[model samples]
Structure formats: C-alpha cells, structure tokens
Target chain A: MNEVPHLMEHIDFDTTFLVFDLLAVFMFAASGALTAIRKKYDFIGVFMLSFVSGLGGGLIRDAIFIQAGPPKAVTDSKYLLVILGAFVLSLIFHGSMHRLKRTVILVDALGLGAYGVVGAEAALQEGLVPLAAVLVGIFNACGAGLIRDVLIREEPIIFKPGQFYAAAAILGCGIFVGMVELGHADHTLAAILATLTVFLMRILSIYFDWQTRPVLDEDDRS
Target chain B: MNEVPHLMEHIDFDTTFLVFDLLAVFMFAASGALTAIRKKYDFIGVFMLSFVSGLGGGLIRDAIFIQAGPPKAVTDSKYLLVILGAFVLSLIFHGSMHRLKRTVILVDALGLGAYGVVGAEAALQEGLVPLAAVLVGIFNACGAGLIRDVLIREEPIIFKPGQFYAAAAILGCGIFVGMVELGHADHTLAAILATLTVFLMRILSIYFDWQTRPVLDEDDRS
Candidate 1:
C-alpha cells in the first residue's frame, strides 16, 4: 500500500540515487587514501589524492556534458565531506583495513559499475552521441584511478598489462547504450543491467587473471 | 584613416589569438612526441601523448568555465590538425631536433606565458573570483606538462624541488587580475603585460636556478 516512503522516512528516487553515489565516492576515496598512506605521502597529499579519486571522474564527466552547469564536484559540499571522512578513516585504521583486500576489491568493483551507469545516463540525458556516451562512461569508471596512480608517480594500472578494468566498463557502457538504442526506454532497468554486467565481468576477470598485452609486444615477436 | 584591419587583410582579434594558440600547440605537441620517441612508445602512443600535451590544459580550463561551451580542443578541427602536423615533424626529425634544447626551452617558456594569460582572461570573463582566475591560469600553464610527465611515469617537474615553473604562472596571473581589478579594462594590454611577466620570470628563474622546497623537508630537518 505504498508505505515504503513512510517506513524509510520519506525515501525517494533522488535519495536512493544519492545513496549509491555516496557509496561509490566513499569506496573510491578510501582506496585513494590507502594508496597515499602506502606511498608515505604527507597529510595534505593524502587528502588531495582522496578528494581527486572520489570526485575527479564525475568532474570530468560533468565538465564534458556541455549543457551541464558547473561541475557538481566543485559546487557541492557533500563530496568534500565524503572525501574527508574517508581520509580520516583510512588514516586511522589503515593497518587493519589493509588486510581486507577481498572486501576492498568488491567495493571497488561496485563503485566502478555504478559510476559507469551514472556517466552513461548523464551523457545520454545531455544528448551525446552513443559512442561518446560509452566513452564517457568508461572514463567515469577508470579516470579517477588513473589520476591516483599518476599522482603517486606510478604507471596507470589500466594502461599497463592488467586484469580487465577499462574493458569491462566499455562492455557495460556499450550494452547500456545499445539497449537505449534498441528501444529500452527505462533508464533504471538499463542502468541496473549494465551495472550488474560490469560488476560481474570485473570480478570474474580478477578471479581468472585476465590480461591484455601492449602493442609493443607484437613488434618484439616480429 | 583606420587602416589596421585593411593592412592585415581584415584580420580580427580571433585571428591573432589563433596564431599564438597554434604556436603554443605546435611547440607543446612536438615536445610531447619527442618524449614519446625517447620512451620507445608505439606510433599510436606518440600521437595520443602529443595531442594531450598540446591541448589538455585548455580542455581542463574550458571545462571548468561554467558558461563556456564544449571544449574547443574537442570541437575544433584546427587543433587536431596542428597536433598532427607537429607529430609528423617530431617523428621525422626527432634525432636532430633533440639537439635544439635551448630553443625548445625558450619556446616552452613562451607557450607557458601565453597560456597563462589566456586562461586568466577566460576565467575573468566568465565571472570567476580573482583568486580562482589566478589559480586557473597557473593550472592552464602547467597542467599539460604534468600530464605528460605522468604519462611517461615520472614525477611531475613542477611538483619536484626545482626551478620556478608554476610560480611564474601565479605571478603573471596575479598581475593580470590585479590590473583588471584596478579598472584596467583593456584586455589586450593586461594579457600582454601578464605574458611578458611570466616569460621574463621563467627565463630568470632558469638562469638563476631558483628552487622551492617541499613542506615535509622541515620535518626531516627537525
């Protein structure tokens, strides 16, 4: 009898979306802060890395959305709060938290999937071409991690030989765009399916140790 | 009689701006491509790095400008053509060109100054706060080089304890914004003054071997 809103203290679609977005931000920020700790960065560096890792991709996506107003990452205070919270937690409990590798990987996968869907949806809403939408989705999924690695003076993991990372985002984004093109007008359903696809693909790729070789490898064989 | 336009074949503000922008793009792209060659990257990687180094800062600045349309680097054909032209030249003459280290340094300084002024002016036009405009100018001047260094898996030179790079941008941007705040509404004069300030400051810094230390260095001393 439509009591879900009352039971959840007036939960709505936007509220649910905000919850997922916050979850993604928290996970990404935690990972980034942990990396900073491992790298022995100072407090400022830790905070900066966490903030960028949590919001950098969304900022890039929003900036490219042409019609979108000022980037939410810059205008919204909540993003900073989330990053700061994550940074504090990471700094305090890093030793114990570092052992939860499996949990961290799972959370990271979920964040990637959610962000991919969010990016793709935003691009489509802005009337971007399908290919561009897919590209945006992939960027939203992996761009933060790339920035984090770069800031730590390491090669970006996605660009190096690694398990399926960006590829999974590409596949999921492609599926979402294809569904919309093929008359699936329900954004929620498409996003759910695409997110699930990316999450599962990323998990399985990690489990199976999938890898992609560089183009230079071919030259060596020849 | 006002014959300036006629003497220049109806050349307008945009045309002159384009000339400077193209010069910066060519120099930055050529430098990036040369780095790629030294790193032994594949052809595709060379082109990609060249494109990013030439245009990444402008893209970031435009993306941040709330009222600006889509980034010109993405929408304009001329930027891509210029990058491609630079890439070809670098690829063909990399060996001989690498010897012109002094010339490359001078050209890079010029590009930095030009981009700093351009970015500050854009931010001011878009109604950003003076501090934000100055920050944007510094970012636009140094962001591309940071990206290039990161892509090649090296510490960004600006971040290291080295010569004054970003500081020069800050000084120039500050001067431009300050002039504007003092009611000097002539954009052309402001830009020219700012550019010359950055150029001269950069040259002097290099010549004098100016340096700044990291915040953590004090802790080490204690």
Candidate 2:
C-alpha cells in the first residue's frame, strides 16, 4: 500500500531514526545478556536471551501482521548481527557496564520510547485498528523485558505494582495513534513527538520515585 | 490440501479423538486457572491464564503457519467456550479437585499425549518439514504449561531438570512422524499409537520418579 512506501520514505530520509533503532536493539540485547550473566547461564543461554530480548517484540508484532509476509527479522541478516554484537560486547564488558548503572538506565528508557513509536507507526501503516496499534506499540516497547524477566523466573516488572514502565509506553502510543487519527501530524513527526513524551515521562517517573499501588485483597480491604 | 480433509475425516470417523482434544483443552485450562488461584490472582488474571494455557500453543503454531489463514482458536468459538467452561469449573471445584491429586495428574498426562498427536498431525497436514512438525507437536503438548509456570514467576518446569515431561512428548511426536514418513501407518493409526506411547511413558516416568540431572557449573566442578 501507499502507507508502506510512505514509511520507507520516512526512514530513508531520517537516517537518525535508523541509528536510534539500532541503538535500542543494542541496549535491549545488553540488558538481556546482563540478566543471563547474573543468573549464571552458559554462553548459549546468554546469547539466546540477548537475541530474544532484542527481537522478540518485533517478531510478535510481525507475526500478527500475517498479510505482510514473513517477518523482517527472519529475512534480514542485520538484526542477527546487531544482537550478536551486543551479546559479545555485554559478555566482555559486563563489569564496566554495571558500573555505569545510571547511564544504562537512561539509555534503556530511551530505547523504550524509541521502540514504542516505531512499533505504533509500523502497526498503523499496516492498517491495524487504532487500539490494537497502541497495544502493539506497548508490546513492542515492553514485551521483550517481560519475556526476559519471565525466562529468569521473575514476574514481569511491568505487570507488578510499583513500576511506571508500561504506562509510559501506553501514553506514548496513545499520543501517536491520536495524532494520526486526527490528521494532526505525519508518521515521522508523530513518532518523534511520541518518543519524546515517553522518554520524558519515564525519566520524570524515575526521578520522582513514582509508583503504582497494588490492588488489595477483599479480605485485606475489610 | 488433501491432508486437511484426511485429518478431518479421521476426526469425524473416530469421535474419540475429538473428545480427547476437548479434554486436553479442559485439563490445560484447569491447570492454568488453578495456578492463578494459588498465586492469589484476581478473577481477570485467572481467566487470562486459563485462556492462554488452553490455546497459546496452537495459536503460536497457527501463527507460524501464515499461509493457513487465521488461527483456528481465533476463528472458532468452540475453543473460547471450552476454555471458559474449564475456568468456571476450576473456580467452583478447585478445592475438591485438589483433593483428587492422583486423578488430576492422570488426566493431565492423558492431555499431554492427546495434544502431542493432534499438534504433530496438524503440522504434518500443513506440510511442515518433518523435524519442524515434531517440534510443533512438542510445543503443542508442553508450551501451555511453560507459559502458565512463567506467568506465576516460576522457571518453566519442563526447562528445569528432574522430569521427563517434554521428553515423553518428543518421543511420541518422533514416533508419529517417523511412522507416517515410512508409510508404515496412516495418520489416524499413527496418532493413536503416538498418544498411547506418550501417555504410558508419562505415567511410568512419574510412577518411577524419573529425573534428569542438572548441568554442574565449572566452578562447582573445580
């Protein structure tokens, strides 16, 4: 469709978006690899986790877009190379990376925002329902982290109370979808705006130690 | 394809296979709902887990079969109804069900076998590669339990050592695929044999307390 070409043109003109996408992949991969290393998984396990964490969300989204043909990750070699590079870097420099905790957190938040916009835009281009597009966007932003945490036998941090993780993505996705529906912005502009909104929200939440309260049991409430 | 009709014909002739398939759905749903209840999840969580555990594997398999149109679980209302029925039943009878631990275990094992045959045959009918068919069969049998365990924040029991869970399914799938490939058995006959093999193996393994050893760490070895 014209939407597909429009998206390709946008990416072709904005090489910065491509760069940020790759950066997001690297950060997500590194986070997964670090979790594996902390869990004392073997090299294979670490590599597997890194690959899944970097690519799983996009893969799921693509799977849902069955009419779009095979998923890009399956056909493209670049994704595999990026994940491999990230895993190697993490394996070799995990100690140093851990020392830069604050930096890593900030980069991860940026990656979250970038992924949200990218995912929502892709879904919208595919003509998904607006609500479905937003959900896909949120999944693209946070699904890999959920998979990573689950693989290591932890409840996903996003699903647990006391985290502002998925909420930021949801807000960003809503903004992008709303902008597109209202014809207020082009895809690229909407993506940029949505990413900035999510990034700022995530940062502020962390800065203010924002948290959600858990739902109490009926007995506890009584 | 001729294969699809052949599978449908087999199911139509032998209503027992259809019954087993439904039973598998119910058992898997019950298992998931019970896990959510034990974890103190809200009703929504219980329903989500039940639905996923009953249908996630087949949904994933169908998603991979992009050429096969929409996933059966999505297109067919029967799966949804069955899962809902199981969830309601689990909610009402969980206490009594827990008391019948042996019966629950046996039914679960039977479901595993039934699901293994059904998944492999479906994949084969879809003309998947033989190895891929077997893998799909194993996924169909074990994938739901893995998702259920993960949602509850536990390492998937199949991935952990000390059980012959997935191994039994693999053996059954291999037998079914091998028989069909060699032209030694028709689809219906092979499915029956495979199901019995898996069921018996699972029962015996549990009876004998079969286990697999964990990989020892290098530091531990030293």
Candidate 3:
C-alpha cells in the first residue's frame, strides 16, 4: 500500500513487522468483504465494510491509543486501490468461501496475533502503562470485527459467549506487554512469543471449544 | 469534575461553552447508566457503561480527531467520581424513568446539540478539513450511545431507520462550520445557532414521527 511506503519514508520499520502488518490488513479486508457479501449489502456497502475492516484497527490505534496524526490508511491513496483489487477478487471467489472456511480461520487466527502485538507496541511507543497497552492491543486485534458485527445488527462475538476470541487477544497482548515491561525482554522476542501464544491459543480454543462466559449465566442464580 | 477545573486552568473557555460541555457529559452518562439498568446489568456493569457513555465522545475525539494527549476523562480523577455520583442518583430514580420519558428526551436533545458543537470545535482546532470536522462532530454527539448499544448486544439507533437523530447532528455541525468558515461568523454565534438547530430538529422529529428509510426495501426489487 502507499501508506506503507510513506511510513517507510518516516520511520524504519522492522521487515518482519511490516510483513505482519500487511498480511493482517489483507486478511482482515477479505473477511470484511466476505461479511458484506453474506449480509447481502450493496456494492458500495461491501467496499465500505472492506475498508473499515482493513483499516479499523490502525485507525483506532492511531486515533485513540497512539494519539498520532492522520492514520496511514486515510493518508495513502493506494490503500483503497489495493483494497479495491482485493475486493474484486473476493467477490469473484465468495461462492467458494464456505468451502475455504478452514483456511480462512487459520489466516484469521494469524491476523489476530499480528494485530495484538502491533497494538501493544503502538501503545507502548506512546508510553502508556501496561494495563492500557493490553486494552489497546485487544482493541487493535478485534475492533474491526466488532465494528462489522455492529453494522450488520448482530451481537458482537466479543461481547457475546462465543469462543475465546477476545480472551486469546487479551492473553496475547498481556504476554507481550508483561514480557517487555516486567521481565525486560527484548522487543522482537516478546513480540514473537506473544504472537505465537495468541495464534496457538486461538486455534486450540476453536478445536477444544473453549468459551468466555458471561459473569453469570441466566440460570445460575443461587 | 476535577477535569473541568484542570481544563479551565489551561484554556479560558467561555462560561456558556463550558456549561454546555459539562451538561452534555452529564446527560450522556445518565442515559448510559439507564440503558445498562434496562438490560438488567449488575452494579459494576452499570458503572462501567456510565463511564463509557460519559467519556466515550471525548475519548474518541481526542484519539481520532484531535490527536491530543491523553483524554481528560482518563487523566482526571473527578470525571469518574462525578459520574459515580450520577450513577447512584440514576439507580435511585430509575423506577420512575418511564413516567419521566418526555423529560428525558428533552434533555437528550439538548445533549446532542452540546456534543455536536463541542466535537466540531475540537476538530477545527486541530486543523481538520470541513468534511472531517462534520464527521467528528456527529461522532461526538452519537458515539457514546453507539458504544453502549454495541455492548448491550443491540443495533445502534444511528444505524437503524430511526428518527432524524444523526441527521440533526450533521445539520447542526454543518451549519456551524459553514457559518464560521464561509460566512465569517463569530464562534459564539455559530455555536448557539448550531445547538439550537440540532435541539429543535430532534424534538420535532420525535413529535412528527419522522423516519430514516433504507435505500431499498426487501420487496422493492426491480
């Protein structure tokens, strides 16, 4: 994306970090477009949702967590052009999406990890405390999906008792922040460990059917 | 709240403007708490929603539009303490809320006007374009309610075919920005006209049962 090049002009991002960020954006954009297709929204709505999902995390991160100027997604023109290319491809292949559910979930899991570490690092760069970093990290990882769900008038998976989606993000972000802030680990190593932890937890949770229940169930009254 | 005094020390806000901002926060916080109660959320849930509803607009504006330092709601202790006081008052009087529905609507209309102007001013101060300023203004007026609805597993009123709520906000913000930027009106005059426009629009919409229709209905296929 053009934003990536512009960011490179300003700051020397690590190669691995840049790759992860790009991958996360690509994967989330596909998911967002796919959601719009499923909801039977119009073409404009599809494009809008795709844009929102692709850039929502960074938008929230730059706006709320990092207190940065305009977010990269908004500044770069190529961002939408690239997203448009992907949108066309997604619409073409959407009929096959159900069959590709497994692959989709695997990639989505990786995006979660990428978003988690990216968010935490952004907050820490702004000198936020560990707790705040953790919250921001989770927001970055899942905020897009939440927004998409809200748009479609569905209960967000994060707030409802679905799987351990937000929990996995929380754990991933917590691990990274804790490792960096408390254990004084190196940035790269902490990020790697956090990503791995979240990815594994997400896959295993889906496999084992783990859940984040509400504070109290409807029938759990004493 | 303590944040107000701290802000006063930093910026010599006109007394009328300061009062509007405080009233907006107080009113939104009350609505947030009331929504939580309607959902039968526990005490902690009520408090958390109240805080979110009260602080969400400023948090979003600071994070997204202004790119300022940490938001006042988070930095000032008195923000939450004042919210807590109102939360207690709301819980005590929530039983009669139905009977007081008309009064509640009137206050909320005023809050929307307050938030809309406040948001536009914050964006303009940050040198954003007129379009973005209007968006931020509407977000300021309606963001807290959107967040509250999402948390409660409901579609936000802004997204649904409700009355002209966000329309009112957009008009108010647009008129204010237009007058200040194009007509060279004074800030105080622009702010007053914008607030009155939104307030009147909201109340009239309710009285006239105005609705925002979908682009295409389910049976409107060509």
Candidate 4:
C-alpha cells in the first residue's frame, strides 16, 4: 500500500524524466529554428517556428485529449527560453550548419528520435490506451515539422518522397510500450531503447532510400 | 412556455444562416485558391491553403471552447464542394482575378464579415459569455486567414501595421450579441447588420490607412 503511494508520487515529480523531456524539446526546437533561419524567415517567423516545433505536437495531442491549460510550450517559461537560446545559436552558426548536409541530417534523426520517445512517454503517463498512445506519439513527433512545412508553403514531409519518417516515430512508440510492459520503465533504459529504435529505423530508411507512394487524385474528379 | 423549445429548434436549423455561411466559405476559398495559383504552389499547397482558410477559424474557436468533433466545416460536405468549385474556377480564370486588386479585397472583406457573424453566433449558442463570445468570433473570423499568412510565411496581418482587423471582428460579434439580446434574433436582420458592420469597418480602415500602434519593447521599458 505504501509502495503504491510512493510510486504515484514518483510519477508526479520525476526530475530525470522531466530533464530528458526538456532535452528532447531543445533538440527539436534547435532544428526547427535552424530551418527557419536558413529560409530567411524574419524574427517573428523564426520565433514562431521555434516555439511551434518545440510545442505544436504536444499542444495538438493535449487539445485532442481535452487536457487543460495551454500545453507545456505556453505554460513553461523555460521551454520558451530554450527556444530563444536555440534561435540565437542558429543565428551565430548559420553558415556552418547550412553547409554540412550530413551533419544536418544527423541532427534531424536525433530530433526525430527524441521527440518520438518523449511523446510516447507523455501519452502513456496520461493513461491513454496503447493504440491511442502510439498515434499521439506519432503526431507529437511530426506535428511541428508538418506545421513548419505547411507554413513554408511546401508539401508536408509525410506526403513527400523520402525515407520512412513517420514509421520511425510509430516504431519508437511501440517499442516504448513494449518495454514498459516488460517492467523496464527506468528513465535511462526507456530513453536509450526508444531513441535507438527510431534512430536505426530512420538511418536504414535513408540508406535504402525507402519512400511511400503519393496518393494521386485525378483532376476534376470533384 | 412550450414556445421556447420551438424557438430553439428553429434557430438551430436556421436555413438563411446555412446559405450565408456556405456562400462566405465559398468566397474565401476562392480567394485562397487564387493566391495559391498565383504563387505557383503545388497541388497539395493549393488544396491545403484553401482548406485551412475555409475551416481554420471555426476549428480554433471550437478547440478553445473544448467543443466536440469536426466543427462546422468538417461536418458539412458543402464546404469541401465550395472549395473544389473555387479551385476549378481559379484554374479557369487564373489571370483575371490577379489584376483586380480592389475587387479581391472587396470579396475578401465580404467573406470575413460572413464568417465572423457565423463565429459570433456559434459561440453565443454554445453558452459563452458576451466577451468570450466576441473573442471566439474574432478568432474564428481571422484564424483561417492567420493560418494562411503563417503558412505563406508572411507576417500575419494581425501582427503587421494594419487597420484593426481582429478589432473589426470583435465589433461585429459584439453588435451581434447586443442585437440578439434586444430581440433582434431574426437571422436575416442579425446577419445583415453584423456583416455590414465588419465590412464598413474594414473599408474605412483601408481608406483612411488606419492602423494599430506597434509594441516597442524599448519604449515600454522607458
């Protein structure tokens, strides 16, 4: 009985998990800010992208679930600070980051892994069912990127010819749920397993040049 | 006493509103399609801009109020059909609307008014207080356009030096509630008054070069 209460409290204030989530958000925000900077987006656009890329997914998920408040990106000042930091950093190193294609892709893969794991973890913690958790996780991982693409008036990456991006997120979420079921809910193990699963899938897809066929609707079918 | 239910049911299925809302959505979708074509956006971008501009505001309002699925646009197939019609029309007369700057703004203002009224009425019906209702209405009216702006990576008209676009929306909605409270619940009269109010405000602003003051952080600090 005592152990149950302790576990509940542990879930409430897990400093390690919180720090891990923040790190994931920071990585995602940095990538988004860098992309906006490269596109020559003005200050407001860059700020908006940085904020959205860090928080858009979570906001969508929370809104869908009817969770109260404005999501973490709005509620937590620290997240905002981190995004600002990333934006400033991106501005300083824009030339180098823009030049190295390999480094950029690597950072993107890391961001994908981190966001995927964190999203799945949030869903599970919120007591969502496994299937819903996976779906939410996928959205959490990709929603910001989708918004980024749409704002740039580009076709979303999901609809583009590319390596399996969404599939990696889904895989990571699935692995996370499986690990939790097997009682490996420790912070380090969860992060490592989920990140590796997504990162490997993304890398393999890039290596093999895997792509999903686009849905083509004939003109004037309407 | 029994007349209350009959009134509620009548208002719930007000056919005049149904027609006006559809017309407004069609007009706005037409503008979005034209913009997309002018920008030479791909099929997805064109389709997305049209969809977002048509439905984005209502969706935002509904989400803010924690209302249930699909909102107005998603629930009605006519909204989709209207957008498709607009897209087809744009393709046919692609060069024509591009040169008619004054005509474009007039049509856009009409659409904004119509959508703003719908948003205000919906919020009132949903039991939001007057202040909240007006806010919701403004959000619904401008949310789609804001999304369009963000997607196009332009400074949103709201954040730019412009006439009080959002303020106009709020004024329309405020009048709508006041009129309804004064027993002007007749759909046609309410719609006409509210829409005219917004349209005139928009026109006056444009003519006079009316604009909101910008927020200067340095000035504030001083």
Candidate 5:
C-alpha cells in the first residue's frame, strides 16, 4: 500500500494489449447476455450478467490483488461501452443465440486465453510475487464464470466436476510467469505461448468431453 | 490516483476503532460457521464460510472501491486470527448455536453497524466522495451475507421479499456520511450516531418483522 501510489506513476500498457483485453471483454459480455436470456431474466439482468462476465474477474483482480488505482473497469469508460454494446446485440439476437453457441464457445476460449495473459501481465507489472501473479491470472480468467454461476444458483464450473476450465488458465498463467521469471523469455512470446496452451487445452477438452473427477467423489463412492 | 500517494502518507487510525473492527469480523465469522454447520458442510466449509462472511464485504470494498492498499483483512494478520478463532469456537460449540440465536442476532446487529462505519471511514479516508463512502459502508455491513447465501444456493437476503437488512445499513451509512460531509460533525460523534442508527433500525425491524418488497415483484404480479 505504501508503494502503491508510487507504482501508479509507472503504470504503462500498450495499445495492442488494450485492444485484446477489450475484445475479450466483449466476447464475455455477449456470452453472459445469452446466458441471462436463457435464464429468462429481464433487460437489467441481461446488462448485469454481461457486465459481470466481461469485467468481474478483472474487477476482483485489480481491486483485491493489484491494488492499482480504481479498477480499470470503472476508471476507463471504454470497458462499460463495450459491455453495453454486447448486451444490446445479444438481446437483439436473442432468438438466434442458440445457433451461435458454437461460435460463442470458440471465441470464449480465445477470450479466456487472452484474459489469462492480460491478468497475469497486470499482476506481474504490479511487482507481485510469481505465485500471486498466477493466482491473480486465474482469477481474471475464471472469476466471472464463478460469480455468474452463483448468481444463477448453479454450482460454479471451477467447483464442479467438469472439463479443465480454470485448470487451463492456471497452467497458462503459471507457465507464462515461469517463462518470464525462469526461462528469461520475452513477454510477447510468453503471452502468445501461454494463451495458445489455454486455447488448445480448452478446444481439446471440448472435443473429447474430458471430465475432471471431483476430488472427493471417488473416495465417497468407494 | 495522482493524489493517492500523498493521502496514504497522512492516513491514521486509532486503536479503539481497530479493536471494534476486529470484534465485528469475529462475530460475522461465528455466524458464518454456524450457517456452514447447519448446511452440513465439513470443517473446511466452516472455515471458508467464516472467512467469506467475516471479510468478504471489506474485501470487496478495499479491493474494488477503496483502492487502498491490499484489503485490511489481508494486510492485517489479526483479522485472519480472529476469523480462525471464531471458526474454532463455533465448531466446538456447534451443538449449542441454536440456543444462542437471540444473543447472536443482538451482537450481529452491533457488528453490522460497526462494520458499516468502519467501511465508510476507510472510503472516506481514501477521499471517496460522500455518496461512494456510503455505498461502501453498506457493502461492508451486508456484502458477506449476500455472498454466503449465493454460495449456499440461497437467494441473498438483500434480494429477498423480506426484511430491512441492507436498507438499514444504507440509511445509517448515508446519515453518517452526510453528517460528516454536510453537517461538519466530528468523526467520532458521527460514527457513534451512525452505528446507533443501524443498530436501532435492525432491532426495530426484527422486533416488528419489518419487510421490504421487491420493486418488480408487485409490478409484475399486478
């Protein structure tokens, strides 16, 4: 905290990363809106879900872990605009959302990977320890889904026995940090490789219907 | 953000306030543990609920809105120790929690008010505008219950069709912030008045079973 105000002066992010982050947010908002529609929620619910899906993880990451000035979501107007746009489009095409499920899932994997890298970068830039950065990265990637599930009264994917969702981000972020800190790799290269790993793992898991057993499920049954 | 560093250097809090904050956290943690046990959760569940209930709102406030250093909950190990102590005590007295319901509620009201004031003060300390500090105060008072309910697959009390829970916090926080900012009152006097407001509101609401309706519930039904 003592050093937080000092670090704020040094915060600098490039345009390319910003664009990718916005794209990820847009995709997540769209998915969230579709879920809200499926749940029979009203326009407000649609906006809420969209907002949470788009920025929830980053919200948690920046506020709790980064302790950077106000969360970027609130400080930057662009984030809200992107989320609103997604909510509107999702509602307009609510009837056709079912048809676009595959497309949404495809882009979602990409968004998750991008967010994983972006969140990790924020933490690393904050001078967080490597492990903390990884955890923050995972939070940035999956916290939205967790919050949305709780709101909808369904078990979060991370807590449920499911394919590797958070696990994908965990590996991607861990490797990204490891690469920079241990392997002495370029940031750009590490981000790309880490994102690809998450994207591929997500795609493969979907195709194979890979199942993660609940940690206690086997023991309980036995 | 530019002035944040300067503000940090000037930040100071007294010991009496610190003690009260810890006591509030402990009470909240004890209630969370009871809820976990009632839900048939294991010891880990007890600890998780206790942690979330004890500090979830402060976590959200400090991280998301306050932009202060890492949340006081994390920065201060005493908070964790208090939560752990509550968790252990609750577990040991698990079978008798039901008998202590009336006493717990009485003290819980006190904690809610204390947390409300503490949260508002933190936001105020960070130089949040009056309205924002009030909002943060309400979050501090009841955000834990909302999160815990969501985790347990129950509708949050704030969203339900009964009680003046969040409303109580809102009024108290609003008055506290208003008194300090508009009335030019002393901080200690303002804080005490605000906490008393919350406590009285809670007690009166519970005694009379005061209820608030969902804004849309009546509209849709009508």
Candidate 6:
C-alpha cells in the first residue's frame, strides 16, 4: 500500500534532510562572511567568499562527475538566498559577532560534519564505489575551506599541517558506509552519526591545539 | 623522402609553434610571480600562483574532460623551472620591474593568445565538439588569471568589468576553428596566426578601455 501513489495524495517532505542542509548552509555562510569581514573586503567579496565556501564542495563533486554547473549553484537559488541572508545578518550584528569565535568554530565543525555525510551519501546514491565515496566526502568537507583560504589570500589550511580535517571526514564517511552495511538504511540515522562523529573529532582536535607544521622553514626562504 | 621521423628534427625546432610556446611560458610565469610578490605572500604562495597561472588552464581542461591530472603539469618539470626562474629574475629586478606594467600587459596578452590556440588544439586532439573546444580555449586563457586573482584576495578580473579578456580568447578560438576548417592544418602557421589574433584583440580592448557591466548592482546588495 505504501508503494502505491495516488493522484490526490499529499506529498510529505523529508524534514531530516532539510534540517541538516539548512544547518550546514548557515554555518558555512556565517564562517565565510566573517572571514571576508576580517580581511576587510567589500560586500561583493564577502558575498563571493560565502558563495564559494558554501557551494564549492558540491561544485567540485558535480564537475568531477561531469555534471556541469552543479545544480546547487545553478538550478536552485536558495543557496544564494541563504548567503544574502547571512550577509545581512552579519552586517547587522558585526560588532557583537566579533566575540563569537568559539561559537563560530563549533558551527563550522557542525557544517563540516554535515557536509561530509551529505557528500558521501550523495556519491553513494550516484552508485559510486566506497573508495570514491570516501574521497568525495573528504573533498566535500575540506575542499571548500581550501577554496575559501585561497580566495582570502591565505595559504590553504589543508596542505599545511592541520588537525586531520580530511581524516575526520574520512572517518565519518567510513561510519556511514558501515551503517549502510549493517541494515541501517535510514538516512536520518546515518546523517546524525556521521555529523556527530566529525563534530566530536574536530572539537577534540581544536581543544587539544592540534595543528600541522608550516611547510616553510628559515632555510627555505633564504 | 620527407616522412622520416628519425631524421634531424633540429631544423624545425625554431619554427613559430616552438617559439610561441617558449614565449608563452616566459610571459605567463612572470605575470604569475609578479602577482604573488605584489600580494606580499610567502614563498609557497609565490610558487602556487606561478604554477597555477602557468598551467592552470590546461589542468582545468583536463579535469573537465575527466583525463584526471593534466599532462602539462606532470609530464615536464620545465614549466616549474620556468616559473622559478621568473621568480628569481623578478626578485633581482624588483624595484625597476614594477614600472614595467605596460610590458607585463603586452606579454600577458601574448600568453593569452598562445594559450587559447594551444587549448583549442588540445581539445580538437581529444575529439571534443567545436563549441566545447572553443570553450576550452577560453578557459585556458582566462582560468589562470581567475585563479591568480582569487589567490591574491582580489575579485577575479573576469568578474570585474574591464578589458575584453575573455572576449579575446573567444575570438582567437573562433579564428583557430575557421583556419582548421580552411585546411591550414600546419601547426606552426595556425598557432602563430591564432596567437597574434588574440594578442592584438586584447591589446586593442585594453588600450580603448573596453569594459563589461558588473554582475551585481549596489541595489542587489543585501
């Protein structure tokens, strides 16, 4: 009876996916806008960074798969709306928000975790192999940060010694794969576990002051 | 009698195609390194900008075609050597070189032209459709600049209104397509003519201060 579709049936939207997607969008957009403000860039610059940081991972994934102009950036304008919304909100609360660095980091971790799971699940849905799915997840989580740093004129944080950002994404992806294999096919459970795993790892790494070594030494410069 | 591959190839080494490639490497590397220095970025930033500005177009084209990492960046290390050499040269003449902005623009135009032809030819070699090949050519010319601008924390010159940068690439690519259709299949002749076309177009556009409209207006700002 569940398989049957009626002409008059009211569609029930999936609330779980909606929540995580909105959370990820908000987190990334906030971080990106703040970074732009710190750099003293113009409004357009702020908008550009926010857009790239939020959509860059998905853009890279879709382009790699030859999807051309990824739907997240092209078809849907919600991402843009979210970016504009964040920009306005940030501008309004710019002074008060400057002291929320700790909060920003936590939200960033949440966004990273959510995006990792979303990217991995999206890849799996596309019938990608597990190895490829893991790669996609890693690319999704850290790829946007790389683009953001590059845009902000900072050395990309990924290649510099870091707190295993990619590693966290990989772990979350592995957990999702494991859950799928264990008959836990529910999207809600998979997303929560993956997101929590990444968030915990990131928070622990930050709390411990884990960081990567700078690639350049005194000798290299001279 | 002239079909022998084992015969001395040195006689044709000085042909237009070889010369164009050499000039392109020199000019593109200089432009890339100069941007890095101007941004006051560290050594890694310098190397990254130089490499991307020199080889980024090819990399993007290869990625689009799903050929994985671009061969130009990998097959030969000459590209790296050229960029490094340019960096060293820039350091040596740093003060005097800043005044050579006009010269840099001219050389950049040449690089743009050569890269456009090379990209179109490469796409044709890959059997891509004509429109795709032209697009690849444009990407090859403009991509490096976009990457450079992004790394230096500037709005990409492409998105900013001014100087038909992409338009020149498009025109050069269109000319290459027309020439190939006209049976001018000799590599040297085609490359030289196409390069000159793009270079002249770019120079004229810049001299005349041609520009485009901004993607977003102030009113559009949130």
Give the best candidate by lDDT: 5
State every prediction's TM-score relative to the real structure.
Answer: 0.60, 0.58, 0.61, 0.53, 0.58, 0.53
Write down the lDDT that model 6 would get. Answer: 0.68
Error of 6 at A10 (Å): 22
lDDT of 2 by residue, A1-222 (tens): 225334446465246656776777778888899999999999999999999998877776677432377877778787788999999999999888868999988887888888887777777676665655675687778778777877787776665455467778878988988888776566676777888888899899899998754333445311
Error of 2 at B211 (Å): 21
User: What DockQ, on C-alphas, does every prediction get?
Assistant: 0.14, 0.11, 0.13, 0.06, 0.14, 0.06
CAPRI-style class, candidate 6: incorrect
Error of 1 at A211 (Å): 1.0
Interface RMS deviation of candidate 6: 8.8
What TM-score would you give candidate 6 relative to the actual structure?
0.53
Misplaced by over 4 Å in model 3 are: A1-13, A76-82, A219-222, B1-54, B64-143, B150-222
Cα misplacement distance, residue A220 of candidate 4 (Å): 23
By lDDT, the better pick of 5 and 6 is 5
Instruction: Select the stronger candidate by DockQ from 2 and 4.
Output: 2
Writing each residue's lDDT as its tens digit, candidate 5 over A81-171 gives: 7887998898777665678779878888887888888988899889999898898889988888888787767767688778888888899
TM-score of 3: 0.61
Ranking by DockQ: 1, 5, 3, 2, 6, 4
lDDT agreement with native, every candidate: 0.75, 0.76, 0.76, 0.68, 0.78, 0.68
User: How does model 5 fare in lDDT?
Assistant: 0.78
- Summarize candidate 3's per-residue lDDT along A37-75 as a digit string, tens digits: 988999888888888888887777777666656776778
Candidate 6 pairs with clashing backbones? A161-A212, A162-A212
State the displacement of the C-alpha of residue B133, model 3, in Å, after optimal TM-score superposition: 12
Over B49-104, each residue of candidate 4 has an lDDT whose tens digit, in order, gives: 66556656766877666375424443455666776677677667665565777987
RMSD of each: 8.2, 7.6, 8.8, 10.0, 8.8, 11.0
- The better-scoring model by DockQ among 1 and 2 is 1
